[model samples]
Target chain A: MIEIPYNVKPRQETGLYNAKLGIWLFLASEVMLFGGLFSAYVLLRVGSPVWPPGGEAQLNIPLATINTFNLILSSWTIVKSWIALKENDFKGFKTYMGITLLCSLIFLVIKYFEYSAKLHHGIFPSTDNFYGIYFTLTGLHGLHVIGGLIVNFYLWGPGKKMWKSEPERFTNRVEVSGLYWHFVDLVWIFLFPTLYLL
Target chain B: MSSQNLEHHKSIYLKVLLALFVLTVLTVAVSFFDFGSITLAILIGLTIAFIKGFLVAGNFMHLLDEVKPIYWLLALTVVFFFVLFFMPMLWEMNLVTVE
Candidate 1:
């Protein structure tokens, strides 16, 4: 049997499993990636004589707000799913994970309408600097949401088999996936205010 | 993995969820008010955002329970992130005037 190191126990020196450490490092890089774009946003807004440039190009605040709550609810559900797994409540885990996935799809669907609305109005990314950055930032974030949804879907579906065989490892896997899901939620937490409110 | 830890997380998760919801509403409410200065409005919005972000990261992501090396890594990332932000300031200063 090939041992998967630190799946259940922490390494003595760092007191973390391999997957936890790796996820944090990955999140740190994700921070830099979003950080760079955010810095660009700030600079562009500051340099522009008229920030947002056009009233017509303003984002749909109400829709974005709804999506914000959607992501937040998903965040809560993902954590709850992990908690269910920790308690060995497979049914509860599946229920919460299903809700989390539902929220993800709802968010993307709302985003789809929002984007289509912009396109219908002929608001392309090349419309202006504001739209340019708006599309770029939110587009990248939407991609992350899709990625997280795929992971959660797999775990909730096919990956449930791990529960019967290696429950502890299964729990760790959910925790790791939860970490990523929360990161995606956190990104939207910032992105919401930046693009919609401000 | 203990019962105590699980219970603790459950309580914290509920509290954090409530806080996040409250903060989201607060951000939206504040946006309606004219702070008299765009900069001031932006500042308040960003401050609220950072608070919400911290709550999610520290609680939901379990950053509060993470190890030292991870903190060190994040600290380093923060340093570089700020450096990247400030690099533009140097350009605006006209340190090297280019025709």
Candidate 2:
């Protein structure tokens, strides 16, 4: 087999495995992707007569607050999952990853309720600027969460086979996924304040 | 990493998580009080958000120990990200001041 360079170890000069470098580069672009929307948000809010396009009361602050903590906990658990791999405890890794997956589901469930509540009252992206930006930001973030959940679920399920054969690479893969998961959490940290609290 | 090192790292993660929880609560609690100025309130909230971001990126994502190249990569991203954020405001000012 033709070997993929720097799969398990850092490249001599760059000091990161190929996957790590690639993921970070991807995340940098992701930053700009969201940054563009956030910039638009600033423009819209500044130009609008009223802030929050939807009234401030229209948002479910308590549910969003719960969702924020839910994401934070998932970030913690995913890191623990990676750590468990380091300890050579696959069971520990599975347990933590399961919890992390559960956290993702709980987050989306709360979001579903939030969205449904909004839609039930005829609020939507088309409703006005507030609902528009609210849907745009949270909708994109929700997609990222689902993406992470799929990858993590695979890692918890079928992807564990890699561990038996190539444990180091498996660990690196987990670390990379954990990094992406953390970035998702990081975005929400800012988003929660930007959209809900502030 | 040694078992000792892994154990030590685990402790750090726990501490960061605790800090995140407290700061999140702080984010909500501060919203309840009147801060007198909207910008000041925003500054306070975003400062807390940035701290939370630092904890996640620095500790959870291991950027504190990350390589120089990645830092440079992200630094460029930050520059452009801010440019993207501020470009509209700059444009708005230009339009307002042009007349």
Candidate 3:
């Protein structure tokens, strides 16, 4: 069996563990991916005579506000989960990670409602330029949330077994996973205002 | 990474969580009042978003205490991100209007 280098220790050359550097590098790319679309949104909105087609008259604000809180809470819970692991409290780790998972689920369920309402109202991505970008930006974000949830869920469940064999490595995994969740939350922080308000 | 520091980290994390909650509410409330021009309103809204972004990145993501290479890499990322954001303004002269 081959053991992975820098799984638990910092690399001397870069001063970061393999997964840590890998995730941040990945996140930098993710930032640009979203940044490009956000640029498109700004260009479209700017050229249009009426941004948001009359200053936020459309779109569901209240539901979006709720989603904002949901993501924020999840961000906190994920950090708490990492902290719990750091403190060697398995039960606390499970509890916090579970809450983080639940919050993400709630966010998606509310998003499903918001999307269903729009479709019911005949507001498809093809409906107009505003709806087009709206669906594009948000749909891509929703997929990120789903992706983070998968990695987080894996860490929260079957991945916990590694705690006994290699506790520090497991905690480091949680930390890296927490960072990804926070990035997703950070995206929504900007997305909420850009889409639902202003 | 030290057991002795967990308590300190916990305190800071709780403070950050409260700050984030308050900022989220402020972002929602600010949208209700007209800040005069659309440009001004957007500036205010985006400013608040940026502040919230900083709090999450610094505290929740632990970027404040990240290693040197990671910081430089992120700094580079920020530069490119702004470049991407501003590139669209050049295209602003040509708007895509859908009827």
Write one digit per residue (lDDT tens) for candidate 3, span A32-149: 9999999888888877887666354467888999899889999988889888877789999999999999999999999999999989988799877788888999999999999999
Report every candidate's CA lDDT. 0.89, 0.91, 0.87
When summed lDDT is taken over every stretch of 10 residues in candidate 1 chain A, the lowest stretch is A50-59
Q: Native contacts recovered, in order, as a fraction for each?
A: 0.75, 0.95, 0.91
Measured against the true two-chain complex, the DockQ scores of the candidates, in the order shown, are 0.77, 0.84, 0.76
Question: Candidate 1 on A1-198: residue-level lDDT in tens?
Answer: 998878778889988888888888898899889988998888888888887887645578999999998899999999999999888899999999999999999999999999999999899999988999999999999999999999999999999999999898888989999998898998898888888888
Order of all candidates by lDDT, from best down to worst? 2, 1, 3
**Which of 2 and 3 is the better model by DockQ?**
2
How do the candidates score on chain B by TM-score? 0.87, 0.86, 0.81
Please give the range of 10 consecutive residues that has the lowest summed lDDT in model 2 chain B.
B1-10
User: Which regions of candidate 1 fall more than 4 Å away from where they truly are?
Assistant: B95-99
TM-scores for all candidates: the values are 0.95, 0.95, 0.94
Which of the predicted structures, 2 or 3, would earn the higher TM-score when compared with the native?
2
Q: DockQ-based ranking, best first?
A: 2, 1, 3
Query: If you score just chain A, what TM-score does every candidate get?
Result: 0.97, 0.97, 0.96
Q: Quote the RMSD, in angstroms, for model 1.
A: 1.8
The positional error of residue B25 in candidate 2, measured at the CA in angstroms, is 0.6
Clashing residue pairs found in predicted model 3: none
